[model samples]
Target chain A: MKKFAELLENLIYSPSTNKKIDLLEGYFKSNNTLENGYALSVLSSNYKMKFIRVSEIKSLMHSKFDKTLFELSYDYVGDLAETISLFWKSNMDIANSKKLPLLSEFIKNCENKPKKKMYDYLFNLLDLSNPTQRWAIIKILSGGLRIGVSEKTVKKALSKYGNKELEKIEKIWHGLNHPYNNLFDWLDNKKPEPIIDNFKTFHPMMLSNPIDEKKDFQILDHKDFVAEWKWDGIRVQIIISNDKVVLFSRNGDDITESFPDITFFSKKNVVIDGELLVGKNCQPSSFNDLQQRLNRKKVSEKIIDEFPAFIKAYDILFFREKRSSKFEFFR
Target chain B: MNILDSRLNIKPLNIFIDPQHPVEKAIISHAHADHAKSGHDKVLATKETIDIMKIRYGENCAKSFQVINYGESLKINDVDITLYPAGHILGSAQILINFKGQKTLVTGDYKTVDDKISTPFELIKCNTLVSEATFGLPIFRHPNANEEIKKIITSLNKNPQSTHLIGCYALGKAQRVINLLRDSGYKETIFIHGALEKICRYYKNSNIKLGNLEKISNLKDFDFKNNIVIAPPSALKDRWSRRFKNKISSQASGWLSIKQRVKQNQIEIPLVISDHCDWNELTKTITNTRAEKVLLTHGNEEALVYWCKQKGIDAFPLSIHGMKEKVEK
Candidate 1:
């Protein structure tokens, strides 16, 4: 946990992208399966330890410290977790617990505990830990690890050990749970990879760069480039394999439930890349029309009929061996 | 009668000095935003304070101006008013109101600590004193400011390859820190954010020698390593700081005295420099004023009021909803 905390601190301060990747790669390389898996959960903001909140910490602190002093310190610090980590008074020796508990062990203890019991458990842990470790614990429980590590970046680091591609990691990512021991064993080539068919998972989609204004058309060959209208609607990758369908935004978030009207496609193990549009007929509508159906859990029938879902399929990748190389959207 | 209520309850003399709301006539105690507001029909302040008001709120800050200086006494509706140096900022002043042989003092966000750039606070003998308690608690005893400045120099000397990004308030703190850096024999050019450029220019126009200062927006491909860059606290944490390679974030504010504040701000180094009076100075100022009664405004008023009562002075907390404790910035 200390090493992971140190890694997070370093990653937060390390400005260069290369340095951040190196730090994460070094952490993943040295840590064990459980540690690396839990570290991944925290860095990706998916840690599931929500037995405590910032308000609870503030109230607990108010009960312990002077009210005026606490309020002044809170205003000055501008962060609740950091304020608690720095000012939490403990009578017990912090060094009594010589060896810090493992991340998995902490999470295991937090499972299904009542709010009161969890508060005591967390208070004990906090007392025994240093400021940095305390900050890490609070950040994990609060689940807003804005230390700049994206889910894609974490997967990218994990792929380095497995000799696996990003899509393979993303495909199996959602199917696994916390402390991914089985995934680690498979990555280390000690066991076969676990496969969960018909489960919703995300896939990294193809992206395009802005056109360069300085490049001369005379020197460039038109045959090598494929030009398409730049649609304002959100880019989506619809993955349909084994009668299971999931719609992924460009950032690799699963939006399958938002546009359920377009989820009932054919059962081919293929990934279709296109723009998520809205309107009747084969022609496209404005992006404003599609905005009505987005960011919603349950789309009403009236809205579905008024702004009907449509996908302007630009390219398709078959689930063949070389499916990664088959992206011809910008060919 | 309360000094704050005098602006409203005292009719005929509808003159407000540092009133929270816009009034027909406002006597600004200082150029700090909370004290000197725009939309006043007439403004009475020191020349420097009026200039600062113009810089902050433009020429339309007041319809008319009556510029007063330190020790200059004026009569406003049978009340004798005088401005004294508050030493909080470049143009900050304390208003001393004398009515019918009774004197009441309004110290608007003052500091007694001696500063290199701003005027030092002068104690005024009065019957009653309304003091700001921005750092009123007993625990807020500030350390030696010179020692704080040496810390920045030492950090720069140690991390010669990293640019030390000093985060400070744009108005007074930035100018004061830069001037202190100059006085400490830091000969290198200090890069500044665009937000500090106008205030820095104002400070320089007032003949405060800020040596070798340049705005970062003007410099292209400039070497920031081993250089000092002063900016607003907000800019140092944002994407703007990414332009410099190997930068260290340092906040130069009195709030940095707290370990929690230092950690929360993500500051690598915390310089405990302030423009407001600390607990000791606040007590010292009250004692030196020789006032029979004391009125507290802003900060932990209740604690200071209790301390005053312990000293056998008639003390009360002034519940001025219009006044803001100028903390940090």
Candidate 2:
């Protein structure tokens, strides 16, 4: 926990991307696999556990210190987690005697527990942790690291650590769970690559890079390239296989829960990449109209009718359990 | 009996303590610009502060100068005024005014912790305390100077190919940081910005042992890698720092304790080395003074005032000029 806290602190202060990657790589090199995996999950915002709510934390702080003083500190700090971490005063002797819980230990202890039990566990853990550790714990509990590193940055660090291509890691990233022991084992060359048997799992989407028109156009043949309308909508992958369908965003986050209307497809074992846009009668609406149907766990029937979503297929990566070649699809 | 007619002036004597505007008679607290201004007809401060003012504003900074050493008392009208070390910068003093047997100490930006370059702070007991609340809120807990200094050394060791550019205030903070680096056994020649050269020379002339200093402008085609350069905060983001390749921008100030402030300034490395007192020090000093009433001045005065009222002490936030100016320096 101390090492993880230090990494978060360093990442917050470090502004350059290269320095942030160095910090992350250094952390991965020093920590164990389980702890490193949990840290990565937290930094990437993939792991979310609301063991303690902000209101509960506020009540606990009020119980511990003067309400006015806490409010003043909170106003001055402008961050609730940081203010609570700094204002929290526990016996240093007792706190130092007990070692802080590991990132995995904390996660497992709070996972699947009742709200009251989780609150008690967190309260005691906070008592044992130092200011920085408490800060990391609170931030992790809140599920937003906000440390300026994107999920892509975390993957870049992992790539640097394992000495593997980032594309390879991204290919199997959505299949891996937290505490990725097998992934680390494969990276360390102690085991073979983990196989994903689930046919509905997301495949890494290929993205385009900006081309220098003057420099890049000179070497390219006009017949080799295909041009399409660049839609101003979110990129999504629709995977439909034997009795299963899933929708994944470009980063491979499962968004099947958000758009149920788009999950119904023909009974074909295929993965198609396309733009998810709101449209009417074969014409796409504005990007703003599509945003109303995004990121919702329970979409309303009214919204589904008002802003209907459809996928404009850009390319087909897989069909009938066989990967389609890029040139073949383009032709 | 009213002690102060206004926030800046002492009643009955018509003397201003650290007044922003020039006046006929001014009792300057320290040489910091907000507290010590030029064009005052008569200026009363410690000898070091007088010299600093002379260096900053030239010989004609004031019509006449009255040097009051620490612990020395001067009688003007019915009030007897004395000076004590504030421990903020070299020659920074807390003005102690004794009027009609009532003592009011005006702390012009002070810190309780010893910076080693300035005189150690001496807590004076007074009936009414007029304190500067620059770091008045409880969130601003400045870490130890040695520990914060160690961060720079650690970062330097980790990235040996990069130049460490530390942005600090030109006058006092720059000198204190240099002294701290020297104390930490950093034996290399410390490079300083051109703006810092004069004040650093002043500190050296005052018998502060800042070992082996070199001006950045004097050297040409120098390898700045694995080296530390101290500059004014403005130079950190400006073209002046572009000369050193792969430079990491760091800032040493109390405001760096807040994460948002560091992010807003885009400082890559934040060192929480303060020249003013933190929250604990401010509250402790207020309580230790045994003062019945407190007049809070400058930064976050509202919080300190609320705290004093809770302690059953009469406190008021004094709305003085120059309150909005940055008080970290």
Give the winner by lDDT.
2
**TM-score for each candidate, following the candidate numbering:** 0.58, 0.94
Which parts of model 2 have CA positions greater than 4 angstroms off? A90-98, A112-114, A263-265, A280-283, B5-7
Across B1-329, the per-residue lDDT of candidate 1 in tens digits comes to 55447342224477876878878888888887777789889888989889888988899878999989999999867788899999989878998888887888999878888886878888999999989888776546566777788878997888799899999889999998898888888888899999898889989988887988888989888565898999999998899999988888888887665555565677767788988898779888888888999988877787778778878988988767666554666
What Cα-based lDDT does every candidate model obtain? 0.78, 0.85
Model 2 pairs whose backbones collide:
none
* lDDT score, candidate 2, position B220: 88
The C-alpha local distance difference test score for the whole of candidate 1 amounts to: 0.78
The candidate that achieves the highest TM-score relative to the unseen native structure: 2
User: Which ranges in model 1 have alpha carbons more than 4 Å from their true place?
Assistant: A1-33, A46-105, A125-136, A148-177, A180-200, A216-219, A227-232, A263-265, A281-284, A320-331, B1-129, B135-160, B163-249, B255-329
TM-score of 2: 0.94
Given candidate 1, what's the lDDT at residue B90? 88
